[model samples]
Target chain A: MKQEHIQQIGAAVAAVAEKNRINHFYFVACGGSQAFMMPAQYLFDREIETPASIYSSNEFVHRVPKALGQDSVVITCSHSGNTPETVKATEFAREKGATTIALSNVEDSPLWKAAEYPIHYDWGKEADASDLNKGVLYYLIFSVLHAVSPREKYRKGMEAVAGLNDAIEKVKTQYAGIVKEWGKQYKREKLIYTMGSGANYGEAYSFAICLLMEMQWIHSNAIHSGEYFHGPFEVTDYDVPFIMIKGIGATRPLDERAYDFCRKYSEKLMVVDEMEFDMTGIDDQVREYFAPLLAGAVLRSLADEFAYQRGHDLSVRRYMWRMEY
Target chain B: MKQEHIQQIGAAVAAVAEKNRINHFYFVACGGSQAFMMPAQYLFDREIETPASIYSSNEFVHRVPKALGQDSVVITCSHSGNTPETVKATEFAREKGATTIALSNVEDSPLWKAAEYPIHYDWGKEADASDLNKGVLYYLIFSVLHAVSPREKYRKGMEAVAGLNDAIEKVKTQYAGIVKEWGKQYKREKLIYTMGSGANYGEAYSFAICLLMEMQWIHSNAIHSGEYFHGPFEVTDYDVPFIMIKGIGATRPLDERAYDFCRKYSEKLMVVDEMEFDMTGIDDQVREYFAPLLAGAVLRSLADEFAYQRGHDLSVRRYMWRMEY
Candidate 1:
């Protein structure tokens, strides 16, 4: 991300903190943007005393929590800033006297107009990792965390964010060749399932929903690794395709167990283990929290390779932007 | 549910509320039990001010929230009352000084032994609707809600529970033949998807994970109806088999959009719409909250019918009890 963009995010968060006493946090978005917010929510759930919840944008509007008021901070994101539900959620949150922040790649978007604080992140080929949507969300979340309780993890986390762009790029470069081999090996498969737990579960979900089903039009679903043994594991067999994202930190055991089981029964199993990746740019103290975002970044290479090998353009869609629901 | 079970559940909740300040709530379980707690969590998220969150059993143990304390109330469930993670979680919650409640079909089980409040519900063929797992959960959740905020919804919900057994039975009988027809049509399908939104999403998740995948070893997934528009909707095609549970009240429009789209694209679509059902035993004011549990009860017949038509015994399992994870 450029220095100007980083400065702008800092200023926006600062302004919100000055004007509002944020006792609760509500993160709302749709599709990929929603998936992107999970790690931050997970962090907030563990790291803070105050409540934070993530919701599908429309669900936020439909089931407006009674706690949502002047003390609530509502953060919403949409790539185009025109996603109807998300824009409306921002508007609704503002009307409820909550602090509303909008993140979008588009300049002067509907979400930008609706929210009290609007921050733009960069996207597409020219965008750096810091320029991506996570930059805006991480800045806001970390700022809030620092304000609420200036703990070491939150402080170290903010310092480490500066290195993440390079760290993620390194991981992506390392995975590029491997993903191409994966692309060729698994090109013809029609259905795939992804699984992970804790922080990285969001990456697995995003990979399945946005990368596979939306971008590739391949039937896919994300199974939480901890929850997998409960029921979904019965589907395990030699022909089944599984992508396992083994997270770092406390939940690793859950992913490892699922991985061990999957490797035994499934012939077509792919893994992106955070333990195997070299995240040199990130600080060791805060690396666990960054694993999901890192895993997600590296997996984007896999999606791209799959798109290439399958001869499908990632941007091509049957409905999404092509039709009105 | 029997009168004894009803009385036992009420006393347990009252005891917990008396001993503890009841500041926060945590629901933990595995597989179907975990899915079962979702409706209660959804209701608590909407109905009360004291925050409540649900987690898969193991994740709850691993990521024990900072909020879990002397003032917290944790409710756990496992059909056998022996799910390792759930037992561990109950123990952990108690260790953290939270009042722990365990719901199970089995008496003298690990989870039952671990919790401060252990309530047994009837299961299998002899289990009445009130005697089933829902009896333990619904009563506990309703009683807690009444204690915290005795809103009409909570009081009316308790009164309505008495009639629910008969109402759910009626819905099941009405769908019995319809499910058999569905079983015949969908018998040969190797893969299927289930979708719902709002209150009934838990039913969709439970039906997909526990009913289809675990019991039948079929590859299945639950796609949130609201999320279908985001990415999963791309999977819509003539041959794709989808079972939709349409929720009532606020989020009905979300489910309807997916249903409308899927009906156009998919030939093999089965639906259980709460809007179509005669929920006579339930009060109109609180019917929306009960829709998920009711939908779950009725869909159990669909699962049974599928097992029959597929020539698979629902009791047969490749992993669950057959071998260790």
Candidate 2:
């Protein structure tokens, strides 16, 4: 968000690249944090020769990758900085001689203590557009991208991300009416399915798990557009509630195909199309990668509206952090 | 399968390796076929240096990998050998100069025509355990592993697979009573959720989608066990129906934790523990990898029993091959 934050991320990435060969990148965390890394992983797969993967914190620890050594970077996030497995994962990565970077809302938290580079990203309503957790993730992703391949376009991408708040604000106001309309429709939903493909699939997953299932206590599952035709499509009927995220990416066609099929069958189909979003600052070359960020913003607003319509607090969780597993 | 089938797979893999420098592998298919490739993808991640990825057939075509070139191998499957996307993906890979392999139930089908190597595998009731599509996949996977980095133990793993029919048959007998009981409980159920981790996750997904959703038109989703703790755990309730597949892989503990927690919350929790299955011929070292194959057999049996209990024919489908998407 801020130039200073961008500089800090760049410097951190540069230091890691200087210290390690950095041939592989791993993004490990739990829940929403893990889902948040999907876009970045997709970026790495498309943009760099070095491999990158996202994993649940426990899986990263239990099935420790042989490739995760001195030449690797492991980035983990925990909003509370006290997610046990995430802290353990950061420690495990550090023990394996990998560069560990952690993002949490609390500074010097348990996760921070375990990481070599600790970043505190903003969360909750007070956090402005530029300093949101997604913003920090964009900065970290592009900073790592610059460190790995030093692409001029990637640097431009970071510049776009640096000045996106104005654009983000405009889109939120534009989406408010639709959000209210959809919130009313979704208020009584007992089961809703979110579908998308490519990087946007992460947004769908977050919407399904974090917003619908966790926040509203609704039954939901994130269905990959590419996978919808397989077995999932068979569940389609007139009464099915489906929310589809349509991205303007290479995988857009996959989403379109699924969207086309679903609209014909399901009456309660809501779509959040990236084409409607105003990503004014993002360059044409990398707009597809940032599409998820835009859609995520709209979905977050929709989540808020849904919360209002249902009279449910997004923070009200039956299990998470409330009970020991 | 016949020893010749193993020899044939070995020869094909050897030829590909000798002709090209294979640095990556891609498995592309649709639906059940796509889910089927996940375990082999896991195998490649754990056992080989060359990275392997599984993709829904369309995603493979739409998001064509930059890594897929002369040094890559693409394996695509379409059981009917007529899946349009599967054919196109194989052709795309071959056009990119990657060695392409196609597995189909029908020989000389379109997908086979597009591939550099074409192999047919048995399917349905008449097919023996050793000649099933899964058996063909195992042969192809191990063959590639042998060609990539030959190991005596891996060869032994193959030898174990070579004569696993009696072991598979034995497990079926042991699992029969439980499958019928589960069928009776699951017959009237309209929704089911499956969870598992590591290679065995493919089994969980296949059970959820192919067996439940597509076959019985039940609403179901496969949740990754490692991911179960994050947001999915909040959805667990006393009446929630869960089919958790417990594997003996590196991520088995993740499954165990989810299983333990689910048992406390969900009264309708059914488990197929790999520990309870008979893997008589599969060596201890490789048993974890084969757990999915064993679990898959049991689930397939469970699917059959469910269908009988519900008076729903497993072959009946509302869309697949019956309607155009």
Candidate 1 per-residue C-alpha lDDT over B78-148 given as tens digits, one digit per residue, 9 for 90 to 100: 98888999999999999999888889889899988999888888877766666677865786688778877
Highest DockQ, which number? Answer: 1
The pairs that clash in candidate 1 are B1-B130, B1-B131
Predicted structure 2: lDDT = 0.83
lDDT of 2 by residue, A1-325 (tens): 6665666576668767686466578889988999898888888877775667788898778876766788888899999899999999999999988888888888879998999888877767766666778888887888777776788888877777766677777778988899899999878988899999988988999888888888887888898898888888888899989999999998999999998999988999989888888787778888898878878888899889889989898888888878878
Which sections of candidate 1 miss by over 4 Å?
Answer: A19-21, B1-3, B19-21
lDDT of 2 by residue, B37-151 (tens): 9988888877765667788888878776667788888888899899998899989898898888888888879987898788878777776766778878887887777766888
Error of 1 at A4 (Å): 3.7
User: lDDT of each model, Cα atoms only?
Assistant: 0.84, 0.83
Candidate 1 chain B lowest-lDDT run of ten: B15-24
Per-residue error for A108 in candidate 2, Å, reads 0.9
- Candidate 2, residue A192: CA error in Å? 0.3
